[model samples]
Target chain A: MIVTVTPNPSVDEIYWVDRLKIGKETQEEYLTRATDSDISAGGKGINISIFLARMGLENIAMGFVGGYTGHVVVRALRDEGVTTNFVWMGSGETRINLTVLEHGREHIPILIDGPGIAVAEGEMNRFMRRYRRMLKVADWVVLAGSLPPQVNLAFYYELAKLAKQAGVKVAISAGASCLTHCLPAAPNIVKPDTREHLSFEWMKLGTKEEIISAGKRIVQDGVEIMIVSHEVTGDIVITRDSIWEINARVQTTQFRNLVGADDALLGGVIYQIYNGAGIEQALRFGLAAGIVSAESREKVCRDMGKIEREMANVTLNRI
Target chain B: MKVGEIMTRDVTSVEKDIPVKELIFILDSAKMSNMPVVDEEGKLIAFISEKDIIKAALPGYFEMLHSTSFIPDMNQFAKKLGQIADDPVERHMHSDVICVEVDDDDLQAADLIIRKNLKSLPVIDAERRLVGVVKRIDLLHHLL
Candidate 1:
């Protein structure tokens, strides 16, 4: 069974206000009445696991959850019929991130960083030991998204190495720090967005060609698959065996929030891989998942049947 | 008729520091779907409906004296109330209060009752103080 590990899982609360006023207090000059709020459990891997569960995939989601917020996240998962095997940390609640949007159209979002959790080193070791034990039972161990400050970026690389040694295929979906550290070690697959691609160049020493060259060079560095998602450009590149260029399908109508698109992509990739689809097919699945997210008002893309139907309409080219 | 003429001044509210358990008691006693959570200055801050309180307390909560006969933690429930209540009412309260000014037509309040899908709308003064609440039942009385 596929195993998804989310290091920093959160209860994502998305809400809408007719007019969101920030910094200054807004008084009702006698007008608007109420706002709408919808909440869900979200984190990259948790999201991926939810989508996988929706598709009737057999997998267990493992992660860190503590305090009251953890309880909410678990309840949310159970409500969706997804199985979770989370380790409860001693101190602090699981983080709650609020994605606040004003009305239906405004693109601006107010994201709360949430409260931090405090864990002792011993507690960390205990969690790691439990994770290792769980990993031993997993068929494909997928490490997705950022970890809480309790663990280092190296911890992810080390965990991937451990999984690799145990013959568990390791897939990492991360940005900046963890991506930089893990690239050299080379996990089975690394998915980076275009924003991440440009950020590394701006932050570190590199040009556009240099970064593409570096991404290309990593094929020799032991990474089996490199998926570069250019979201704004609506295309994804699968650099393995040969370069495969896949474009996102155009939306039939107006789209909603862009949140959880990447996680859906990852879910599509994992689903394809688990079903024994080749790399090219898996890449197309990932692209379709990302594109389908725009079709729904909620942005979580709950309908896999719709996604598959939409994917058929999307064309894939081998470059 | 004026908004104040039709509004109910006998309104019930909870303090900023009242525990969630006590709020549950108030909710149970008031038989209210929603409460106008107010501050010491009597300004409407936030509101906690039965639904909001239940969603917060039910998930992952344990009762210490579930089997005991003694007055179970009213505060156990109140602790949740306190958690929600401890914050400033302004922080969580619906600041966009659908209010009718002092001299507005009573018909406007009736429209608000139907359009906003609110059981009641707090009628306020120029300073935004809670003057009275016009319930749907009261508006129905006017219609009758």
Candidate 2:
């Protein structure tokens, strides 16, 4: 079974529109939407769990939630057949991120910060306590998304270290603060997007070679698997012995939602690994899962059959 | 909604070896009447409550009479409270503790708390490790 930790999760409200324009003063130019809207539970780890559960994997989603909105997030995950053990640790409602996606236009996202999580100290302890117990049953633990205001880099570092001590595999897709700290703990896998790699001076450009060598050095420092997912050049997966590049060909329609694709990719990798598949197979399977979600314009992959069919289109080159 | 949906996740717990004096300070500081006790590996083994401490502090005659009328002096009560300084939490804690799972329904949790007369229901995952707690107040807060 897999366990995912999303420190800060939210209820995302996506609005579809033909055109979206922001006006300085209550004007008619901004009055565009009437097409459709949907709300879903969100957070990088929760998204990954959605894909993992869709792949017939047993997994649990854990995080901090509060107020009525928090309840909605939990209910959303539960309704989707995703087991949840989220901690009701703080006061106030969880955040709701509003996204306006216009046809043939840029996606406009207005994010709201969540509740301050008043008892940050106590909740951090509670989260770790729960995480340790869950790690006992977990084959892979994915730590993803932004940390809540109170949860800092040290928390993720401690969690990754705890998971390692339990002999559980860990795949982390977090931001600079958490990811940089976790690298020293040597997570089983680290998936930092191309933009995140720019933070490191050596990986400023984020080229395929630069990222691969950096991923290799991370292996030397203790990371077992390093995956640098680039927006333009595609994904590069590396281990100490070999480098694998799996970028599948899939036709994306005019409407697309890239919000959950990264999580889908990591979920696919974890899914293949949990089933005892080799790196080559895992990469191919992971890329296909990513494509399946990206092309569907949904936060989760609704069809495992489609991913399986697209598996043949995935190209894994050894470098 | 399940008991877990409204449970307080930041539970204050004490280890078995915790000194009673320190335990008292913990409970007082947290304004709590009872807390769950866990072993080194963090499995719920017992529970300690204000009632247990009072029981431990009471004179032996009180047990036979089941009454506190004999202790007529307020000074005697102060002396009885001092008895808590000696033993560790494990020595005074109730060995049998009941816990609820995260998936348990709110109604079942309410029933357990009512039947057992628990101030707070300790919530545990499948592994029997403490996760959070559902306090009596938490339930009342929601119901009222």
Per-residue lDDT tens digits for candidate 2, residues A8-74, read 8888877767765565655554557448777888888999988887777767888887777877887
Best by TM-score: 2
Q: What stretches of model 2 exceed 4 Å from their correct place?
A: A23-29, A105-119, A195-197, B1-144
lDDT of each: 0.67, 0.75
What is the Å distance of residue B11 in model 1 from its true position? Answer: 49
| Pairs with steric clashes in candidate 1 | B19-B82, B20-B77, B20-B78, B20-B81, B20-B82, B21-B77, B21-B78, B45-B93, B46-B93
TM-score of 2: 0.70
Candidate 1 positional error at A268, Å: 0.3
Displacement of residue A236 (Cα, Å) in model 2 is 1.4
Candidate 1's residue-wise lDDT over B37-101, tens digit each? Answer: 65545556666666656556442434543653554556665666556654443333454556676
lDDT of 2 at A263: 83
Worst 10 residues of 1 chain A by lDDT: A200-209
TM-score of predicted chain A against the true chain A, for each candidate: 0.87, 0.90
The TM-score that candidate 1 achieves is 0.63
